[model samples]
Target: MGITQVQRLSAGALKPLAALVDDLGLAAHFQGDAMLNGIDPVIRSPHRLGEASGTAQLLIGIAGAAVWHARTGKKTDIAIDIIDALHYLHPTHFVQQQGQPILVDAEHVEVNDIFLCRDNRHVMLEAGPPYMKLLKGYLNFFDCGNSKKSFAREVAKWDSEKLETAMATAGLPACRAFSREEWLAHPQGAALGQVPVIEIEKIADGKPVPFQTPALSPLQGVRVLDFTHVLAGPRSTRTLAEYGADVLHISSPAYPDTFAQHIGVDVGKRCAYLDLRNADDLVTMKRLAARADVFTNTYRPGVNARFGLLPAQLAAASERGIVCMTANAYGHSGPWAERPGFDQNGQVASGFAWKEGEPHKPRFSPVFYLGDLMTGYFAAAGMMAALLRRSTEGGSYHVTLSLTRSAMWVQELGFLETTRQASLPERDSYPARMTSIDSVYGKVSFLAPPLTFSNLALPNASRLSPYGADVPEWPA
Candidate 1:
């Protein structure tokens, strides 16, 4: 059964959550079931995107707060606001500055929507600033009139499958739209099926270090080295930061993200710079890794592995057991495992786009960036669960998830067809869900943490800062 707006998570409700916990090998770590704090219908979406992500929030909130529970014999029984529970998934869409909603330069035909190809099929294309340099040469070939329609016209001359293959082989993000059945039959889909929805595995042996005295939040005193960009990866570390982990987000000054994106994702953490290519900078990061409790990377799986920052590498660099998380697009075991991708690519490749718009127009889910954002919630839960496991078992653990994998899991949860066509709320309609902070970046307000702890707090402990604004070193 597909989940919709659930006001309260009854005993029999949220069966999909349990199935996912078993799939991720985290059932043993869960102290008990979680619940929702408020009524739903807060988020607008056809699939159970809101409910699935909301429940994911509930899972991680309790997992992090459980650290406090372990010390004081408190049950960290938390209730996620059925409405605000989904706000964090699409932070930019709801962020406010001086009482007005912030705007993201998110639209461009070159990287924006579906294009019809020669074979009468469709392909999703993405060429964001970070990867545009690599795609420039290839995209310029289709530079007809230098207009979006001209670009679409040129795309129509190429077969969908060939165009997708060429783009992916060049390390660019592109995927042909496929129906649910067609996706299930593709090699990439078959490969993804072999991978778990989420993977949390121990990779090294070490001594257990119990949780210290509970203080500000559940993850007080814990240090997280965040080497992630954009959504999924950053959101995971952001959640940890809110729960009292000293999260230091590392980004290179060489390649910068739009200031809007930085504002959306940098909340609850200190933004710093470190060039991994520089030997001295690498040493600094290694030293920090050796002392960190959790490390998160959102780069394509092997990109950081080349720099000796992979799970096993980080585990070896550390003195004690640590939690390492890797979030990506396709998945680790697939033929397209290393393929670079974005949220819409996941939707296109995994049949969501087709499901939403078929025989007419290929469309993305109504919710803001469903695939990538939902994966963030999965990453956060996996990290907290792995950390909880490491504190008791004493082994470096690795947590892994992908946008495509999250899309597939949501399919398994079932969609609420009856509510699929419901009228939705517009932007800034609910100010109560928004939280403001006098951040280092400035006075800013955005979506709060989706879940609330009965025993802990919300709004996190830190302020948003511009990228590379802080020194590389962790807080002393």
Candidate 2:
């Protein structure tokens, strides 16, 4: 999509809020102008950079507040700051420890960057255990070692497309960067653009169960079962936790996440472990789902189906009905639906990386997983809307979102071009944007929630449990 095409997308991005309200039959209750405040020309591009993201955040907040009103007959003003929204998009960058900024290891970055191949094309390789294993395999395929230099040298020996094909065959997460024209013409990209940014489907029928209004917050008594890992899905559950939902995050020992990645997003939730492969543990998960009001996951399209934990299955297991929200890297459609992906892969496959840097050298967007963050915010909004629908209409809902679709929305929103230099906030300014909280590890500083309401405050408690620290059962 070009600048002109993206400009047209900006208007389309804002239509979701109205469509959501209409879809849920809540047009009568929702009132207010859906506008974002305090956005300027800081990060320049062809699209409405700040407005697009800020508006999505604002809409989610409003939707949450609207759900509150639906259950309690109380209305609240919703607002979001563009700067804060942008900051929330890259929370890792703004996180601090004691008084210093926490730095990601250089080796981590070196291994995860876009590399030039023999054909003069660029491919991104996200570095980690499985990725590193795949990188080693690719190197071995080319008769190379496991060092960064060796990986780069071997990558340069193969054509970009050839390497991408080999990595895909090995079920690895790697992709060759595509230009805007190339991406739009690609089948995956075309399918992605057609997918809704958020799709809420009524999967099962049930009686309307009105949520009890709480003295503290709208979601105070709600139970959210989080089966997400990494950034996007975790961030969505964290948003619910901030609003007073009892969020229990489930993971397995087989899949481990670094403290650096989990610490920022794990705040305000309980953590537990359940090995689904074990029949006993699978029974425990189903019991938890039976009592859960909402369930969220980031497992690729069919992985959950193998275990019979798909959204429809979860809804059937739960008596009170449930809201199931899921996200993935590519999308839930197209040839790449089953393909494993991440923020970097989405950036490369969706053409965002190509536009971020110069014509010759495409750099991953410096904004840091904006695609994942926005998807989280969008998921939160969609989940809230689904909740409201269940309260009124009575049915199980499945809400779907993806990193690639969010990239498309960002592309449609386009970018803002300014000669002004955009720099990070000063250390002194960090105090206002960040809050200190006690965790199992120790004191951690992280960014505050981006949205605000006139009636309720987001919980300030930031205690985080160690991975699998709690029992699998939900609170009695």
Candidate 3:
């Protein structure tokens, strides 16, 4: 039998929102129009990027409200402005520190950029820290230095196929751009098409546990153990923090991230460091996991399994059971499941890069990291749904999300092939969308939370914390 589409909103374009609610089995709890109001065309790119991003944000907001209702028996209305929601898709771009725009792009390494191969094909190399060691090996093998131009010149010596094969063999992250037809026929692309945008499963059984009632925010008193880095996972945890989840972000000094990469997203969360390989640190992590309501991580599939920190393991340790959420580059299934990747690689593999420019010349999506941003919001929604299930059904749930799957959702949203020409709305009105706050870095201006509830004021700008600034234990 073919899949049945559930119709909740009268607007056909909002079917995705309805589909998301139904997929999460949250149709009964959702109230209000299926489509989020005032977000049409705010993103204003070649595709309905803005609409999809806004819809994801709204879904998370609605889910957060639903969780609140579940705890307090009080229902609330949710809403989002299109422009405000769009800003969330690129949080770093909108951050202002000390009355100046913080330069967010400087963290990108020069060697980690797009280059043309001898076959006239373009390939993107994600030379970020996660792959820095492997990338350095590749660079040294090619006798190339730290210059983008030098890397490009050296990479031109080989065809795209050869370079791609070499990078894959070396365990470095890279993807050559492909045309729409080429991408559809790719094995990994086909596999991704068969997977759901968010995968949720009951991993362990437990006794019923009622959600803690909140005094101020919906998620107050909920403790979250966050072992995620970069954007997608951190952004999701950040969303939980905005709603009053007591989130403690964990990082590794062995694998360091720069201040610029962590600054904006670190708001409203305490930060700490832990080297899981160390015996004492591992014991400390297990203690935290045993007490945490949720455990979220972005490490690839088996990386945490080595540390005995997999979802089932964490669930076994917790007395009340716990919700586990994971986000990654490719996904948990298929040949690329264990492969290293980043948002740029997902965009290229998912045909976004190919479609951004002409057939001969490909362009990466420069506006935002849609894969990371949307996956963050989608993962947040899944975590909330799992929490709801735990509250009612008494089981530990695992929610898995991937950048590639998010890219497919964006593709499914399709492009806006309109004949009418349009330009982005003026930025003079943007000041109205921002809020100023005192932060660890300095006085900072940030975009307000895009989604809103009738009963709640916009969440205060996140209180920024320096990396590893807090102890590794939960608050008393």
Candidate 4:
């Protein structure tokens, strides 16, 4: 609301904007079809993750062009309104169904918060209710009257490093907090430094194929096999669906998402359950992948390989070419690649949590979501880039991402505290940004997208479905 009329990047692309993006390896993409906008501070954090929200928009702009190019051999100009994108960090906060919120139980005090250890170091131990059965092995202080305070006391008994190692050994979720300087020196962090935020590699060969059918959105008819959970991975496919991709979100009955997580990210998709451990479900997921143009999985790094769902393997799943993408907790390489991770892990390991320490708390950031939400856009951008490459380069591709990698990029955006008298993006911006759609769950409201293209429409008209509400098969 501060400025209903946002400026365009190309005609008035400010030089000050380069400070955050110069090192991101996106100048080339920026120079390409993407024309970035919105260089103002919108988020409340002292960190630049919110101000750099435009980076996601830039990626979305580029993806929009790629979708347009692949869908119809014609070029198009895309404009991104970046405010609502950062709002997506906490999808449940903004979304509502039939006046009732879809909620994942958020009160897992024993499993969800940060605690101090004997090492005097901070570590976030996370195994949300949905993941407790999945990522096991941790302190067993479960009590008749257990509280966060009680859990903190138990956590303090273990050395931070040892607890981190123990959790990693058992494939549970936890990480020792690192300051920016510490992150640079840590072995796993060092390994992360060697890679890009989003990795898009051509893994197989296929002929270029352009869409012949007419469509209202850039990704219309594009089939996306979404085998993912939680915020980061699900948000990626949801963005793809907004572009008109036919996203099929699959999950297992054994490990279910919170109702809020399902409702927030289920827009414009077919949600189904298929436990890969089961012979028939495994076959079903593969069959869907075989017909998909995009394949995404968010299991810990190597878990997909066990099910024969590796990028290269799935790249060969379709002859027409597929954009295969994956998300892990840590970076794609190094000691922590196989360890499970989540947004909090990224926040802790990438130094954001430490930097966010307050006078009352040594390490904490209320709920800043750059790690999870923008990382989703990162993977989505990678998939779009891979899709663009497929339409022109004639090959199948693989895109990789991790929570830490995305969080690191946010750090690279530079801290906003250094800027002059920065306040939050205008509260007035809210009313203009909210978009309500009538779906299966009454009038559902969520943040609108930060991008627009000439003559193209957002897929908001599509209804949101409940988890596992649809069949596994693609539409006939």
Global lDDT of each candidate: 0.74, 0.74, 0.76, 0.71
Pairs in clash, predicted candidate 4: 81-450, 102-260
Residue-wise C-alpha lDDT for candidate 3, range 339-416, written one tens digit per residue? 878887888777777776643466555464778889999998999888888888897989998898798788787765
Mind giving the per-residue lDDT tens digits that candidate 1 earns over 1-476?
A: 22233444346566766666666555554465577654334445445655677778776765665666664556545666555655555667877677777755454434467889999899887765335564574466565554567768878999998898887767667899987778878998988777777788889999987878756567888899999986788877877887778889998889766677777777888889998899999999999999999999988766686788888888987988789998888887758888988888888888877776755687876654777678887887788777777778888999988898888877766654435445555332445465688865467887655665566664346577788888988777
The alpha-carbon root-mean-square deviation between model 4 and the true structure, to one decimal in Å, is: 3.6
- Candidate 2: which stretches are off by over 4 Å? 1-27, 33-35, 44-47, 99-107, 128-143, 146-148, 418-432
Indicate whether candidate 2 or candidate 4 has the larger lDDT.
2
How much lDDT does candidate 4 score? 0.71
Residue 359 in model 4: lDDT: 31
Taking all chains together, each candidate's TM-score versus the true structure is 0.91, 0.89, 0.91, 0.88
**lDDT winner among the candidates?**
3
Q: Report residue 226 deviation for candidate 3 (angstroms).
A: 0.6
Model 1: lDDT equals 0.74
Can you tell me which runs of candidate 4 are displaced by over 4 Å?
1-8, 11-38, 73-76, 80-82, 105-110, 134-145, 358-366, 418-432
Model 2: per-residue Cα lDDT over 351-446, one tens digit each: 887887645577665565667788898888788888888888898999998888888777765555523434532121323366787655667788
Worst 10 residues of 3 by lDDT: 1-10
lDDT of 4 at 326: 84
